[model samples]
Target: MHLGQLAQITIYPVKSSAGLNLTQTQIEPRGLRFDRRWMIVAAATGHFLSARETPQLLQLLVQPSEQGLHLQAPGLDLQVATPAPDGQRQVSVWDDELSARLADSETNNRLSDWLGQAVQLVYMAPENQRAIDPRYATAAAQSVSFADGYPILLLSAASLSELNRRLLEKGRGALSMARFRPNLVVDTALAAHAEDAWKRIQIGAAEFAVVKPCVRCVLTTIDPDTLQREPDNEPLKTLIEYRRSPKGVTFGMNLIPLNQAELALGMSVVRLA
Candidate 1:
């Protein structure tokens, strides 16, 4: 397995929604340019929202426009401007809250009904004030799409296989890679910390440096199909016992591409000393 060859490339234009697969994708400092750049919000409270709290957001399908953004679900299709209005409102992600824009009335109504709730849309704007967590200072205060806080999440296929082996031993059903929601999935011949070696690796025409190990979260416990939090927490517990980091048990490496290059699935990835 090679690092450069993309085993899979998926994007959630709308946070918590289904991912779109692409044979080739652009790599930007803050992850794919249009990635989680836009998010649906709560119209009444002017708060930024996500599938983390309401997993139903996963059902919304987003259609990318040259400028406008459109989302459609069960029976609703809503279209709005790319950069939301100028007026700012306080928006929160987990514990961090920041200034963001609330979508206009028309768009909000459309999305709310589709979601079977009252909600609006919000877009993260370019700003210089944001900063990364102290532990990930190496990532800097770069602008990020709607992705939690990190730019990208990378996972190794072999790592998942190893975990599945353990699951089988415990008589647990096998899990799919989608459960991890990785932007870059590498197939590493090496053992643990295989991604750590990505510090300087070439895949196809692209080169990258591992920025930091991604900390696992409760989101991992949420099953995409059922959209319900798992009870056993077997994988997470197993990871903690085997893959705990100073922050926590980390399964993937968040990476930033060092050089721009055309990348495609099945391309060759080489580790550089």
Candidate 2:
């Protein structure tokens, strides 16, 4: 087979917000560093969430930095430290309760006001423990922080094109590439499930192994722009019809890097299979 290009790269420092676009990015076992490493959870219920369930979150812009995170809200500009505040708060990701730090009172107030609800910003602590679903025997016990479910989500440009073709046929607007929220997007000119043939692949000098086929969820049904729930998006609806896995309708690929270096934009990728 011929070589594949690095189609697209994205990082969501905070899940469900506008993602950072990259020409290329590193692939790591825990995912892109500082990516989905922190999250905001309901203080009362301890459940983690994104703008999908709460569109108000889009009002908060999150940018990751070496120091921690630079947050911009309606009227607030705050820098949350990496260690964050020491005060402990109970938080949950899916079903895991974790000890976490509240960003700062001022920041919290701005966020709550924007959200129009009382809520706390929970930073994923180094001490916080989160494990992947046990049903994925190979990925179980693997650590995750603010991520939705699996460690990574991969999409192919070809797949998006396929979806777009159908959309154009129906005279619908072309979908934004961001809707799928993939860490790595490949130019797999091959047919659907082409990535499944990739047990291992190389991006630039970094090597990655496919962990599993990423499972789809309600998150996909949520409009990334309006932040409104639309359970009938065609691609998502079609995914359920044709690609449903025993785990559920699966799309993209989840991968773990074989190296410890960072990947950048414009890097060349070659499939090693």
Candidate 3:
């Protein structure tokens, strides 16, 4: 049955950097094409950097280019070519350690200057198979990109509207969906937090398994436009009052694609199981 319509598609080509909104995209095994395929890592420790600790990352604008990426910040505008496979480096994304290809030294230097730290841009080459956490994997050998956990994150507009309604009642301003960084947003008549019960769904020509409810973090309290922490942490503080679970306060649902296909805005969403 029709449950909703796809409202938005967003892809973060580089983890932690700004996301690029799209009207349509192809879904691959890992995720939407170019989604979180590139990441910034500490040069010394080889650990991933995210807006949770480095709010400055939210200010970096990244656009996917034919050759690689076009990155821009207040004083920096640079074109980074797709890294060749030869420069191998071990990078850690949370608990997952994998081999990734490092971008050229010039690109690394420019980014480091922009962030005022020693950092390198790394790419997950096709051969670097980072497995999805087995505890949550529905299919054997499922792989994912550099995303925080799952391949795709889905949220309903109705859910955000409900959150905003509560925020307004509390004398707080509304927030945009960008704060949550979801790959998909569905406009539906479902009640607030209804997606938490979804087990399987189909959008456009692709099917997906709703794997888990997304656990929100301090990253949600940062303003994407100003790159500053909210003085009151309104949304998160409010969410914790009502949305807390054993895992943490939750906001969205994580998804794993079941097949290769294309997804577009306005596509009907069907609950399968």
TM-score of 2: 0.86
Regions more than 4 Å wrong, model 1:
1-4, 44-47, 84-88, 94-98, 125-129, 134-141, 259-261
lDDT of 1 by residue, 1-273 (tens): 344345877777766777766678777655665677667777676556766688777667776654767777667666777654576677666556677666677887777777778886776666513344556545455545667767677787888998888888888888888888887777657674577656666778777666688888877777888889879885797778788878888888876666556667777767774
Ranking by lDDT: 3, 1, 2
Best by TM-score: 3
Q: Quickly count the clashes in candidate 2.
A: 4
Q: TM-score for model 3?
A: 0.98
Clashing pairs for model 1 are 4-203, 5-267, 36-146, 41-120
Q: Per-residue lDDT of 123-199 in model 2, one digit per residue for the tens? A: 77667767766665354457665777666677888777777777677676677777777887777558856886677
Q: Which stretches of candidate 2 lie above 4 Å from their native place?
A: 1-3, 24-28, 73-76, 134-141
Which rank order by TM-score, best down to worst?
Answer: 3, 2, 1
TM-score of each: 0.84, 0.86, 0.98
Scored by CA lDDT, what does every candidate get? 0.71, 0.70, 0.93
The collision pairs in model 2 are 23-265, 24-264, 24-265, 26-263
lDDT of 3 by residue, 1-273 (tens): 789999999999989888889999999999999899999999999999999999888878888864799998888899999888889999999999999999999999999998999999999879998999999999799999999989999999998999999999998889999999999999999898889999999998899999999999989999999988898986899999889999999999999999999999999999998
After superposition, candidate 3 runs with Cα above 4 Å error: none
Worst 10 residues of 1 by lDDT: 128-137
